[model samples]
Target: MSSDLGRAMPIERPDPLALLEQQEAQRLPWLLPLRHSRMAENPFAFFRGAAVVMASDLARQPHSGLMVQLCGDAHLLNFGFYGSPERQLLFDINDFDETHPGPFEWDLQRLAASMVLAARSLGLSEKQQSRVARRTVCAYGKAMAEFAAMSLMLMWSAQLPMKDLIDQRPSANLRSYLAKVTAAAQSHDSRQAVRKLCEPDASGTLRFRHQPPLIWRLDQLDEIWLGGLDWHTWMQESYQTYLADMSPNMQHLLSEFVCTDTAIKVVGVGSVGTHCPILLFRGKHPDDMLVLQGKGAELSVLAQYVDLPVPEHQGQRVVQGQRLLQRASDIFLGWYTNPKGQHLYVRQFHDWKASVDVGKIDADGLRDYGILCGWTLAHAHARSGDRRAIAAHIDEPEVFARGVLEQALELAELAEQDHALLLRGIASGRISST
Candidate 1:
């Protein structure tokens, strides 16, 4: 009874500001202001950036103990569309920075809370928000039950056909919205990225556009930031190490292109202060180009709570987690160590990758999208966890949905209070806001 979803809130939790500042200490100092500014935009944005806060809070409460490879930060916005290795467009969990094996319900609870926050941001009524959140858990229970009845291999190989699901939507407006998203996602590739992010230098060499604190070339940084190491040598060594882990065919395919540029690229709400760099490569043909992104990997937020063996290389842990949970992962997914001995994972950049805008959906659209996300999460959990046990645990879908909805509503209130705390911290000079 103590593990009842409705009763899962911790009686006492750490000061959110303290936890935030402690987490920020590990990030790039200069980018802390940007992170604060982004989180201050809205409560949902704060929720997006505060996975550590959630992890800590969730650990203080009782859990179902049904472990799976969590998306780590399974917020609604984290689900998206990306091209598979065979060029098929697919939909599933897109972020795994906090990924580690943990309670299946932790992910479900996060997804539900995100649904409520996102619905509120979209101006949905309280009833509508509750409907969306409850629908997500209901769908998850149903999907897990279905997977529980399937053969192991069948469940493992199952993929969500997002296009077909969209087409099946009863509302024409929702279909139109999803169609636009799919169309936009298809065009979100390297060529589109090149148009937006690249410009020719004086020597007619294509390179990443120099955009100050957000995007910059290595040479653009001051010597103090460079710290006397040669980035050119570092890039060469890091790139080679990344390639060594790739399959022979991929390595051979990549060898056709030469690295032309690499730049410091900042992205995402929670990931703002981490090391993210984008690379440009060009082949013999003038039009042939590729872009790859590298993101620094830290130990999962769940790492502190779970007693699992720590991974020797954080990047490898991320790479392995993505490969396991995603129906089809990026073909070039790999990892390497930087000159500073930090671990980073690499994947193709903007290769038909895009997320639905949570702010733009109506009540019906939100409910539909939540169901899809729930089903997708269930599919992922079934592959790496015991589907039958999970299905049996959440046996009464309606009752379980109500309890999870209550938990989400409570968490949303906590998030709002935490968001206010952040605002007060910024005003008081305890937290940075630039």
Candidate 2:
């Protein structure tokens, strides 16, 4: 925004080998599997293996604007609704640890690519897929304009609360699934989790009960991944930043409720292989306690595209971005640098955490939900800075929707192309398998 970044920013992308050398943040094993996926390529195993190459190409794209913030491996799956500091239910782009101020198109490109891939997976025809893409882009266009008209307070206040997002929808299929998820989520309270997961059975010692796709004890992951004193130290730093960001009352409440000194297993898709440890802080009663998750933060992928001078410490980036982007942020959100020199971003793991399941929704449902996510993401982008100009640039959803459909088609091809290249590299032994 401060500069015509399209021309000003460097387009020199980082080399794959060089990017992989950075610390925990640089290694993304999840991308490897996708590159090797045969659906995209077979000579070397296509989708299972191409993350580095895709990022490399993405980093080289021309800059769009600088109102951008970090977008961690943003894909269709990553966009979801969560409760904001305020109780009002509205949706927005949720992940930000790897956020950066680079080409706005970078986010768009990634989002479009993911949407096409998702639609393809759903067995939609090419034309049908493009329609889905068009609708999402159109939604984004309107949402951006809508956001440009709002005040910071209003933008911050809106949240697509789990209940509101799921409950408001008219579909019975979604309602049933959401109801089940909600029940499971609410029932698995800290007290309940502690009573079940943390409390050992015959052994009689408190330990994490393995909850598939959700909760796992620390010992489950490989040693190299979760290993080190660095994790513990980072948790402390993350908590300190959390303290600085919180109101006195909430800070004191968190301090009393959280144990603040232990590590637990945590999991996420893009973050599958990283070291994410949960820190428990028990307060007045276990029921009144909170769960602070210190997930690992990595270098912004945008770094490949723009010079985007940022905090050298990834933990600081996460904590800083959360404070800047979200008005009603988690009271315990924080970051710290550990003795082992690792960085961790700390926050309450679940403050009514919920997300829309677009994959399961019917074509019509996905269309509407896609629009909602686009709108919410635009609103978020607007809140981060002056969005009136961006809004003016694309007022109606029509042109942008067409542009998005075109871009999605192009990006999908690009993904397939890069995935093929990755297979070649892997076969030649230039890349490593997970």
Residues 322-413 of candidate 1: C-alpha lDDT, one tens digit per residue: 88899889988999987777789998899788888876667888899899899999999998798999999999988999999988998898
Q: Clashes in candidate 1: how many? A: 0
Weakest ten-residue segment in model 2 by summed lDDT: 41-50
* Model 2 / residue 127 / CA error / Å: 1.1
Candidate 1 regions exceeding 4 Å error are 1-11, 223-227
Give the winner by TM-score: 1
Q: What lDDT does model 2 reach?
A: 0.58
Give me the runs in candidate 2 sitting further than 4 Å from their true place: 1-55, 70-72, 84-90, 150-189, 192-196, 201-203, 209-247, 258-261, 264-266, 284-286, 417-434
Candidate 2's TM-score reads 0.76
